[model samples]
Every structure is written in structure tokens, then in C-alpha cells.
Target: QGVKVSGKTVTIGAATTHYDVSTDEKLRKACPALAHMASLIGDPAVRHRGTIGGSIANNDPAADYPAALLALGATIITNKREIAADKFFKGLFETALKEGEIITAVSFTAPAKAAYQKFRNPASRYAIVGVFVTKGKDGVRAAVTGAGEDGVFRSKEIEAALAKNFDAAALGGLKVPAKGLMSDIHASADYRANLIAVMAKRAVAAANA
Candidate 1:
């Protein structure tokens, strides 16, 4: 399955086991940078078979796809209808995808610049605070995942700062609130909050580079 956005429609295809890149060549062709970026998602087995459609459909709060999808302003395309990435993700392991709604594809306008930074838990390799930043014609958007205890979220504070100045130095003085972040044996809420800043800075540096 894949997602494609055209005009106001965001279409999501149903997930399947097949690992044919040809089926979703449009996604890679349209966004080569993102395609090159996708190669870094996981190990060989994951890249060979793991589907973007499957990833988005799952909407795992700790997964990396949701944050990049949201930050890129991609649309979630389903048989039922198109949903904005911002609206598609509702909460932890939750999305607006209704019953029987199959995601066909996702569409993105391509960012002027974009970058993703993740601090992984050694054991799980899951992001403690994954930050995806995109600078586009509209402005800069920062989507954060894996940090919220309740669900994935956007860092408006970071977005605001980046919008004003798209640089790491711009966020130097900003603070990420520890309230509402995740805490568990792997990491504490404060740790995650601190990572948000660290990852944000790294993401900015990467984008700039």
C-alpha cells in the first residue's frame, strides 16, 4: 500500500505483503530525496519489505514515519477519503483511518529543505524523541514523535522559532516542557524533553548542512 496526494485529495492504498518498489515508484520518483532518506529507515529486511503505507497505517507513536509525514505536510490517502497528516494522527496508536478505509498513497509537495533526527533507545531502537523538520513555501513545521506519553505531537514552540529563524541558534534559548512527555524504564519524561531540544538542534544542523 502507498499514499498519494493530489490537489485536496490524500489517497492511501491498502497494505500488502508484496515488496515491489515499482508499484509505488511514483513516491520515490516524485521525492527522490525522501526516497534516498527512506533507505535509512531500518536494516535490509525492513527496507526490502517494510512498506510506507503499512507504517503510516499503523500510526505508531514511536515510529518514525508519522513525524516525517506530518512535517512534510503529506496527505493520508485512503479509500474512504483524504486526511491531512496533521489530522490523520489522533493519538497514540490511533488515526482517523476508518473501518475498511485502505490507504492507497500519500502525496507531498516536497520541502525546500527537511531533516529528521532521532535519539533511539538502545534496546528497542525506537526514537525517544524523533524530530522531523521541514521548510516549505508556507513556512517551517516541526513534528515530534516518540516522546509524548499520550501520543505523537507537534512542537509549536520549535516551529515558531524555526519559522522566525530556521537555524539551530534560533532554538538555543527555547525550552521544551517536560509535562505530558513519556516516562518508563527506558527513559523519563525529563529525558525525553531534553532530547527534543537536542534532536531539534541536530535536525536543524542536518537541514542546514
Candidate 2:
């Protein structure tokens, strides 16, 4: 597993483990939100064994990487070609990888300000609701995970609000409709919708902090 940096763009080997991603000095500097998100995934054992590519390849609905990757506009590098994050995730436990396609690395230009926040399940530690927000060349992006029925997705409302004012308070009184969100024993669609807003606000706060 390796991480390479060229100017503001950073490329991380697909085999790199969550632990490595969480602690790599270069990655931490280049993508603090990603590193912090990695740090919050699973337990120590899982962090040491779970690879970033494997996680994204699995495309688990509750996985954290997709939120940060999507919000950061990361490129998924595969043996066949590169895929944009927006086009990568298909749905629950699905991705754009083809039969013979293999992921090699994931790359992104570090954003100016970003952070991720998740409300997690106590046992498995998967996100019940997660949000990652960034303000950079893309202006502002807010990606939500663990709530959408179609998996990770951008919140246009949150993005528009942040574009107007990139602050946690800017999201005040914001509401995310529960129509397309998931409902489980842990949380209802309405509950996750509330979490989406709460987590987005927290993520913006962390980015500013």
C-alpha cells in the first residue's frame, strides 16, 4: 500500500488499509476529513484489515468513504479507466466496476475546507446517518450516506445553503425530506432525515474548527 502526492492531487493505492489511510501523514495533511473518517470506521482490527478500495468496491450503504469521496469529487482509478465519484456508486452494495475491472487507486485534489460527521450504530459501527461537506474549487458540496435508499448522495439544499454561507448556522432550520431515505429498526426515514441535517451541520462546524 502506498500514497503518492503530486502538487495538490493525492493518489492512494487501492490496497491501502483504513488504518493506513487514517494515520498516513501525507493523507492526513492532504485530506484531513478522509483521514478522520477513516479513523472512525470499525474497530482497530477492522481498521487494520479493511482496505479503502475494498470498502468502496463493496459499496456498502453505510460505508463512510463514499460520502467523503463523493463530496470531494474523487476519481476512482481502475484497471480499465478512471470513474468520477458521482458515477461510481450505483446503489446498496453496488458500484460501477465491471467484470474484469480492478481498482488501482483513488485520487482527488485536496479541498480547501472539509469534514465528515456520522451518527453510527452502536454494535457494527456503521453509519446510521453520515454527512461530509466541503468548500473548495467545487464551491460547496454536501454528501450524505447511510440514509439514502440509493446509497450516498449529494444534498442540493445543503450545498446551496453552504454556497450562500459556508457556516454551520447557515444550515439552521434546514429540513431534509424523508421520502427517499431508508428505514430500519435502528432508525426511521424521518429519523435519518433529521440525522442528515444534524450531521451536515456538525460537519460544517468541524470544517470551520
Candidate 3:
């Protein structure tokens, strides 16, 4: 329920709500992109009610946090052990958390630049395709949510493009293959695929802004 800033690291308590995350002045200054992403999540009620830990523990494929965490190289701290974002998320509604282990906190080092973008579903505000891009200590990472059948994942193509140019123009002609993406009533696989590229480009532009 608290946000703590320690030099280069920011640690958010598990019970912290989306509203808190979005509004924290320290967080907004240290990680504007993450705060911006929190600001855009759900409506007022949902944001007020949704805790960061609950959201990530559930690991919803359309969830916004996972993409941001993954791209940011966040660490998921639990009562038992710590898990890297790269290995924390397994698939839809899945995580590396062992039975009875509860998430205690999440922490990440602020990146040089980062941003998140999503094409939302009008009814639920869930991302039809969400992208979080970052240029940080680990280099470039672009993670996608709401599109993968296996759940949130990094877009290697987007990473390579951004690493090369670090601009929206870098994604020009880049095509996200529909093969592993979702095809539900909300959107077809191809549409979500395209949105991945579009949102990634938009996120990069936003980060640069």
C-alpha cells in the first residue's frame, strides 16, 4: 500500500492500488511512463479497487502491468523468494509463485526512457493489444499484452527495430505475425498483431516525447 523510492530503485507494496500508483508524485517523476500507464487503467472504480499484487498474481493476458513490468525488468518479490519478470510470468493466469507464497512487493530500477500504449476495448477498457517499450540498463525491451495466446510476451522484432533506430519510424514496414496472437470476438489475430506494431510505435514516440 506504499510506494518507496530508494536512490535508483522504486519499490511498491503489494497492496498498492492502481490509483495510488498513478497518483504518487515520486513515482510519476521517477517513472512517468509507468505512472501514465496506471492512470489509463480501468475506470475510477476499478483503479481504486485493483491492487498491483492481485493484478499480477492473476496474470490476466490483457493486463497492463505485466507488460510494463516485463519491459522494465522488474523483480517480483514474494514472501518466499524473488522472481525476475522475464521468468515470473508463465502464461495466461500463470506465474512462478509457489503454492502459499504471496507477493510482498515489486521493484525496478528507473529506466532512461519508457512508455506504454494500448488499443482498448470500449466496454471493458482492457487492452486489445498493449505494448510497453523501454530503453534501460538491460538495453531495449518491448513487451506485448492482450495479444498472445500464451499471454504477455516480448516482441523481439520491435526490440530489434527500436534498438536500431529508437524511433517510431524504426517500426515502419515491421509486421507482427498473427500466428501466436489471439483471435477472439473482440479482435482477430491479424488485427491484434497489427495493433502490437502500432502500439509499440506509439509507445516509442511517447517515450521519446
lDDT, candidate 2, 1-209, per-residue tens: 77887888989999999999999999888888899999999999999999999999999999999998999999999998999999999999989999999999999999999999999999999999999999888699899999999998999989988898999999997989999999999999999999999999999999999
Q: Model 3 compared with the native: what TM-score? A: 0.98
Tens-place lDDT per residue, model 3, 1-209, is: 78999887999999999999999999998999999999988999999999999999999999999999999999999999999999999999999998999999999999999999999999899999999999987799999999999999999899988786799998998898999999999999999988898898899999999
List per-candidate RMSD values in Å: 3.5, 0.7, 0.7
What C-alpha lDDT, on a 0 to 100 scale, does residue 18 get in candidate 1? 24
Q: What's the TM-score of each model vs. the native? A: 0.85, 0.98, 0.98
lDDT of 1 at 74: 83
What's the true lDDT of residue 93 in model 2? 90
- The segments of candidate 3 whose C-alpha lies over 4 angstroms from its true place after superposition are none
Go through the candidates in order and give each one's C-alpha lDDT.
0.77, 0.93, 0.94
User: Cα RMSD (Å) between model 1 and the true structure?
Assistant: 3.5
lDDT tens digits, residue span 8-110, model 1: 3333354532233333565454443355445556566776777778877788878887888888888877777888888988887888988888887777786
Q: After superposition, how far is residue 204 of candidate 2 from its true place, in Å?
A: 0.2
Q: Which prediction has the highest lDDT against the true structure?
A: 3
Which 10 consecutive positions of candidate 1 have the poorest summed lDDT? 14-23
Question: Lowest lDDT 10-mer window, candidate 3?
Answer: 156-165
1 versus 3: better TM-score goes to: 3
